[model samples]
Target: MSHAGLFISFEGIDGSGKSTQARLLADHLRGLGHDVVLTREPGGSPGAEEIRALVLQGDPDRWSARTEILLFTAARRDHLERTIQPALEAGKIVICDRFADSTRMYQGLSRGDLRAMVDDLHRLMIGMEPDLTVLIDMDPTKGLSRALARQTVEERFEDFGEELQQAMRTGFLALADEFAERFVTIDGGRGIDEVAADVQQVVSTRLPS
Candidate 1:
């Protein structure tokens, strides 16, 4: 969170409707006359986008855990430098689809007990956290089914299957508790309109556009 701008991030399981909710919030904020910059992780800047393709498009096991962490850190550093920092400095609202939290869950939790490594890299390279983080919580089984319905070339992470996804759901929930200062949990099991309303309420109450 920066004093000059409102930085919001959305976190959830693969099919927990986080992406959709994040977009709707950005639109709603824009309608309220706020300058909003909607972006996604692993590819917000040009360099990060290049890293995103490399990290996501290949086989699931293409890179070892440590190497993958390095790549993600590189992307995040570029994102912060090229896209996020500038937006915040200009006093615009930045709504990111994901941030370093995804790295904690995906690379650290899923691969092994690499949480410290993730935090260390983030602290060293990209030290800022979102001003507000909306964690859309949902049942892992349901989320996985919804995720599988959509087919994409970037299915490498999804290839890890439901068990890991369940773990991820728990990990994210725990994170909300750990980082409660900037976290809000939304029940994404509900309808889109309801979820959007809840998300809007949370953001408006905190940021007011």
Candidate 2:
């Protein structure tokens, strides 16, 4: 779907610092006087946020892969209706920390080979892709370490262990290749400021003058 504003999403394996970069980029763009909306998947709008708690904060086996695709798609649908589409229609930059790509990895690839199902649901329910996607590439082991150190209730994904992280990193890089036109891969193994600087530079090129 096309819109007047830019829809940018950040994707990465666990602890790739995509969330931090998304926030930093939003702040940077807002400082430059662009109307910006910073949001996240599974929990952007109130309804989606409720779904987030259900999907993100439970046992690793709490939801089956098929069930998760449905939940995530439902949450994404609510988020799109309540937050994303409106912001873009108003010509605002919407920076989402995570989006369908993340689900494509976590639920679609992580548990089993359900990517086709995820894509089908996405096409049926959420027929949009970000104008740009910033992928923060990091070492799976290091990223998992950083993620586990956070100790948040949302660690169900991380709780799946480093193997899942490894698979996710590989899957994300493949996704980047699949969607090369809209995906910009950035090394996230550097300092926060360094990664943020690269992110800002990439995004600046895409934003309106």
Candidate 3:
């Protein structure tokens, strides 16, 4: 589908500073006079947020990988229908903290090898990819430490430990390679202002004046 606005997504392991960077980009864009929609995954729209509570609260093994993917896809569908698409149609840049890429990394790499299932569901249910994907790349050790410091009810993903996080980092990098055109890997180890400058520079180049 064609859109007048841009769709940008941030992808990374549990705590790779992608979310913070996403917000920074949105703010920068808004400051430049572009209408910006700052949102997140598993729970962008109302219905999706409801699903988010369900999927996030339960035990880590409560849902099987197959079932989990189905739930995630369902939430994503709701998010797209209620939040993302409308904003894009209205010419508002949508900056999402996470998107289908998170599902691929978390579900396929961390949980189970159901990547094929994840891809099929996304293609069938949510057939759209972000116009630009900013992957805030970081060392798993550093990212994991940052993640663990944050206390939240949404500990399901973080509970996966550093090993899984390492795997996820690898997976994200591989995805960056696969979707190189839309994907930009920004080193997330630097200070926030420094990283934000690079992110803003990259996004400014892609976005229209």
Best by lDDT: 2
Best of the candidates, TM-score: 2
TM-score of each predicted structure versus truth = 0.97, 0.99, 0.97
lDDT per residue (tens digit) for residues 1-209 in model 2: 77899999999998999999999998999889999999998799999999999998989899999999999999999999999999999999999999999999998998999999999999999999999999999999999999999999998899999999999999999999999999999999999999999999999889966
Model 3 C-alpha lDDT per residue in residues 1-209, reported as the tens digit of each score: 67888999999987889989988888888888899999999899999999899888758777787888988999999999999999999988999989999999888656878898899998899999999999999999999888889888888777778898999999999999999999999999999999999999898888866
Task: For model 1, give the 10-residue run with minimal summed lDDT.
Answer: 200-209
Backbone clashes under 3 angstroms, per model: 0, 0, 0
For model 3, the superposed segments whose C-alpha errors exceed 4 Å read none
Report the C-alpha lDDT of model 1 over 118-209, residue by residue, as the tens digit: 99999999889999999999998999888878988887878889998999999999999999999999999999999999999999887743
The TM-score of predicted model 2 comes to 0.99
- Backbone clashes in model 1, listed as residue pairs: none
For candidate 1, what is the lDDT? Answer: 0.92
Off by over 4 Å in 2: none
Q: Where is model 1 more than 4 Å wrong at Cα? A: none
